[model samples]
Target: MVAGPKVVHQSMPVLDVQYRCVAKGIEETVDISAAAAAVAVVTPPSSPSFRPASELDLRESDAISDVALDVNVLPFVPSIRSGSYSDIGPRRYMEDEHICIDDLSTHMGSLFKCPTPSAFYGVFDGHGGPDAAAYLRRHVMRFFFEDTDFPQSLQVDDVFLEDVENSVRKAYLLADHALADECTVNKSSGTTVLTTLVFGRLLLVANAGDCRAVLCRKGEAVDMSQDHRPIYAAERQRVVESGGFIDDGYLNGVLSVSRALGDWDLKLPRGSPSPLIAEPEFRQALLTEEDEFLIIGCDGIWDVMSSQHAVSIVRKGLRRHDDPQQCARELVMEALRLNTFDNLTVIVICFSNEQQDSSPSQQQPPVLRCCSLSAEALCNLRRWLDDDRSN
Candidate 1:
């Protein structure tokens, strides 16, 4: 007789057999397969959780994605009824400014199978020049993606939020330095940076200068980005402290806008309360099914159209089965219709394809949606630097 514990149980799946074995072995070795035939318990089946129905395009995506813009000529601007401006002004006679887009993603979580497609669509309305917007086009989106914690879990509290905010601030400052190094001809180059990024379910929107981002949630208009206008209370105070007086009719004695890039002429004094800064105001929002499309455009659009009016037209256009490109095109067309007389650009981003019934309400009157800044317009901004470049 052998002295040892009994082999109490065995479980088998496919080729493998597992058992609760206690060694009670004598010198005689028996076939182990028979030992596996002990008590085998069958576990009850359970259903797997179902995933949502919305489908994602699975084809491999490029780091920089390009979609052609629908170029339309506005023969008569007044015919477009969606916005306040009636004339887009003179037709341009120059080389077409190239508009390109690039995105980088982070895979920081289990659900992060692919790089979070941080999509960016900006409408830079270049006035003094395209350098500002062009600078942004080259660096802003990439800057945000670089060194960022991808798919960062929201469970992190204030500490994480602070880190994120600091990251963005550093990115902006880096862009400023990078611009100084890259472009010599356009030292005064500046552009309004209005960027919207979608990573998983989080939406981060950042802006500097007059460009704006408006979010349409549940058929209601929401301001996602704050316009850094000269008249904003904080901006006004900053201006006063900088010895820059807001002229009776303007943001300040010199510049019409309170906040901007490439206006190195407006930096604050050594001991000024609010330092001369071009840092972007940042906002983070959790995106849900209710969040519709996002509209980000230069001041040209926001100048002529109110946030609510822009939302209405975009919502209606979407209801008409307008794609993101179409909605963006229509928004630009509307701004031109209002006679904005400035560089016009619009980027409309549809978050999801799910549709819903319109809320019962009277259509509000058309407001304004003018915008400005362009990557190609930087050529003109170089001249401004020669005129102003204070240390």
Candidate 2:
């Protein structure tokens, strides 16, 4: 076992005080605060309700015959107070990639022809190999900003919104096309991308494959993106329409996701076009005072935790440690604790709200617990099931 370098903890920043409503019902209005105590985000819980893995979606992965947890991922909870902040925690995937591109303070935004100096966050979960995910992470921002009609600045007009959407669409497609064109990249390698762009209070989330984005508006969990899995109704319909078969929920008996970047090798269609596509779907939101934090994670985390469950964990982490970075690390650790079989990566972005006081007292956070099957046993079961089906 090798020791990994220590992670530098965040020195809690003195956040500029902002306003948050004391009122409970914001169903009538959109503007709100991110502070957990000030606003009634979700039916002001009597006690923080943190459920385990059984309540949310779960996907069984190949069981591990040899499982060893890395010690480098030191377990620590950290936060960045005041303003917008982000953190990442990686767990056991050889191919998962996360990028935080914040150019707000630099002239890079203008140089890239972007309209705003907003930060970009992406989590790419790679399959087959790391090439596809790594490629997209390196070039996502370039494609997003270099394209024609990218936003110059914030415009209230609907036309500009359309243009921004178009730019994102073009960027995603271009990235996909680029992967297909790259001779060195393995055509068999593919990746699931979940990217979030923050412009002031507006959040534009683009998604492909199963990586998920969830916004903790107040205390309530709000889904910012949808998973594109092979078994999904719409996804299945499209696969069939494109002359693809889903053998045991696998796309054409090969991939599990219906949409992703790369997979040129799987583009071989019996009669129709390729079953896999790189086009991403978009979701937009206007952040308010009540929007506490947003989470972008690979399927490994979501497989064992619900949107609300993940939010509950982050909110509790913030209340106790007040650190988004630590909160992210905790999330990955929690998933690992639950015995997840896939790679894990989770990002938590907190929006700073107007604080009521200079030094806020730390609050006691709720406790949580979960269960999981050993990787070896699960893998054995999966193989047995597969053999049974095949025979």
Clashes (backbone N, CA, C under 3 Å), per candidate, total 35, 18
Task: Give a tens-digit lDDT track for model 2, residues 241-325.
Answer: 8788899989989898989988878864322377788888999987655678888888888888899999999888777666677
Candidate models: Cα lDDT each = 0.52, 0.67
Scored by TM-score, the top model is 2
**Cα shift from native, residue 343, model 1 (Å):** 1.1
Determine the backbone clash count of candidate 1. Answer: 35
- For residues 1-391, could you state the per-residue lDDT of candidate 1 as single tens digits? 0111222222243324222211232112212233222212322224353222122111222112323332453221110011111123344621112232323233223443332444434444443456655666655556654644432443434565566577667766666556555644265455556655554455677777777888888878889888776778898887777666777635445555665555443443322333335687888777665677677776767778899898898888777754566776777788778876566666666765423232224232221111121212212222232243442
Give me candidate 2's TM-score against the actual structure. 0.66
Which ranges of candidate 1 are over 4 A from the true structure? Answer: 1-118, 121-123, 147-161, 180-185, 248-252, 268-276, 354-391
Candidate 1: 10-residue stretch with minimal lDDT: 76-85
TM-score of each model, paired residue for residue: 0.58, 0.66
